[model samples]
Target: MSSYFSSADLFRIAPLVVLSFGAFCLLLMEVFIKGAWDKARTAGLFTLVAFVSLYYYRGQFFEGSTAFQGLLFTDPYTFFFAALILIGTFITRLLSDERLREEGVGAQAEYFSLLLMCSVGAMIFVAARELIVLFLGLEIMSIALYCLCGSALWSTRSSESALKYFLLGSFSSAVMLFGMSLLYGLSGTLVIPDIASALSSMPAENMGILLVAIGLMLVGFGFKIGLVPFHFWAPDVYQGSPTPITAYMACVVKAAAVAAAIRVMTLLFVHGDLFSVWSDAIWFIAAITMTIGNLSALRQRSVKRMLAYSSIAHAGYMFVAFIAPETGGLSAILFYLVTYTAMTFGAFGITMIVANSFPEKTDADDISNFNGLGFTRPMLGVLMTIFMFSLAGLPPGLAGLLGKFYLFNAAVKANFISIAVIGVLNSAISCYYYLNVLVAMYFRKGEVSPSHPVGMPMAGALGVCAAASIFLGVFPSKLYEIAAYVVTTF
Candidate 1:
């Protein structure tokens, strides 16, 4: 049999190629450059160009296609995730520029290149229609992140965080791969669609093999989303890594994994014999993840750690969307992801700004550093307030309110009313810590100076994220439409 590639498939996979090529070019540029040049400028420009190209190719999304002999598939679902990752890269790059300068690391060209590579991996992971491809894409993303986490050469905390992340991440990957192997052994194929089709008729075959595979996969996904039991690494890593990278991991990486999980559980599982067996476990995890995340966040003095815990809670919210039988849950999950991204990136952007002003002390993790911030830097205080309010699920910051509303609504329709109630209570508990920051900023007074200046690059990034949060909070219909379209396309 002669194998031929399709042009439509090529077009659908264009964004991944563009990002990979851009990263490659930047890597080569970093090698050739001499002495003390600003690599961030080069990297940022390349990232922006790549994202613009991706946006241009957005028109190609609705037409579904598969490539590499059906190893990867692209539809509106993939396009939505690809758009998110690219935009995430653009924002992270801008924020990283100043950090690189502060550390006296002359060329950030390589760092940005790695970020682009990571974005490519994340996009490909969501588009993967086959098991081998999924594993490969995940490793590509993980390796890049491992390196990025430790890139702050001057910070000892960065190195430690990287080590812990690497060890735990490697362990999770091993379990996931073993599960995939078992799944393949039982199904005689590694393609997701084929596996689903195979499972439909294999009543006598050991479902245990598939269960192990999915269970291990869940462990990996849980780690990525920072859910309960597997969430131990997030607080340390978030506090220790460079702030911008932490923000990137919190928003973009988590979103990609959740998006992929939505496909795997809802789309693939619905067609397989595994659905009945998996639903209970999913419900249990969702409940524990939400309760534990909210409870743990309440006592955190480190602002970054608190946010890390909150990210886990957000994952729990998205997790509940999976229990709904209909694909409406998917729309809710995707919309929540968009809102989460805006809120989180905005929060981290403010932290990044504060880091520049008090590099020796602020550290971006200390909650006390924020005391009387409203009196010192009014604009940053206001932006931080927006992030906090949005995160707390309050109005004018739609991330919390709208995200939780849709999630709970979907659960109610699915007849998981009790689950929805617990979810709402979890959201309410989450408000306490998120609002604590606001209290610190507005109510407390301190002796610190108010004259610290904000870096232009960092400020610009913060402004964009803040604006996105408020804009989406006010009129979320556009994003909901896009998310709904993506869910239906799959």
Candidate 2:
């Protein structure tokens, strides 16, 4: 490798530089700046830098350019998801503004900085072309989140959730690192495609270690994606964390991990020789993940925990696309992720509002607290209904419905019709629990009522989400066409 750095490399990574330095500037603001609207001003700084960053991630550079002597690269695959990370982070900040005031938390600088840095890490994670660089990005994002989860020092659940995440996340990292080491040893390469190239011609004696490497890495990513059996941490973590951060985990975190998985898995499936080795394993994981996620969600009374389980099921849906990557799976996954972001934030945003309206207690998030809410808060009722309907894959909730159509269509195209049927069945199973919240809000009356006032930032954020759910559903081609083009490039 050349010791010299080219301008092309630097230009390609300029967006990340802007974001990383922007994060640093935010931390410095604590010393150099202070006053009323401090957070508002901080948010303004973040928004300014973030949009500048997005200017590049959205399309400033040609796809397929590498930075850092090929350790990181620019491509439509990277650009699309990197842009999504920025969008998700911006929305999270919008949602968090109100919560920050409500919690009256100290060290506002650290809080917003971590959120910004997490987005930086997520972008790097999705852009990385080498295993070590990928791991670096993953750790940067994971460590930021571990600390963010515990930032609410007033709550013991917050502390506990942080510890649990830190410990388990560390273990999964170890497992994944070891798997990467094994792959490196067997394939004698660290670049993912090179690793796949070397593995394709491996001697029969090394097949065992190769299989072990694949399985171990799947175990590691399964923890990150919340596949069933590896999902013990999700419901607890989601319920215990602050609501905005919970939504962050559901949207940005899941999207980044799955995008990385697609890169890794694509190398194997396209290579053909090794496709069957993991094909059956992915199928089983997808089946059980969808089944268990929906079943567990059905039992949850707390909206947060239910959404946690719902996230797991969505992971399974993405895996269905994996089964047919050659048959529009990648495009479907990209489109589904966009719709998933809109639907998820919409649901969680309203859930936060309804809970925030009542007394401050653990049970405030309970669906029973939402009784007769449709009558009292009609807007919230309508928005929440749109989100729930989308998640259930029903009509007028057309985002979820169409997202599933693309996913299952890919599966059918690949001749993997069985899993498509199973996915459809799971979709039907999910409807009961998703709609139950609507029953609580509209059909039942209870003592709970909105006692506190709210702001437009959240409403504004939710309105964007509702529009996405409806607009994207009616005119799928608008976003789907770009997603398809990006996937073709991938």
- In order of appearance, the predictions have TM-scores of 0.95, 0.96
Encode model 2's per-residue lDDT on 57-165: one tens digit a residue: 4453455666677788687777788778877887888788776645434666788888888888888888888999989998998999898888777878878888898
> On a 0 to 1 TM-score scale, where does candidate 2 land against the true structure?
0.96
User: What lDDT score is found at residue 360 in candidate 2?
Assistant: 62
lDDT of 1 by residue, 248-297 (tens): 99999998888777776564565444666776777888899999999999
Tell me the spans in candidate 2 whose CA falls farther than 4 Å from its real position: 1-3, 56-60, 101-104, 268-270
Q: State, as a TM-score between 0 and 1, how close model 1 is to the true structure.
A: 0.95
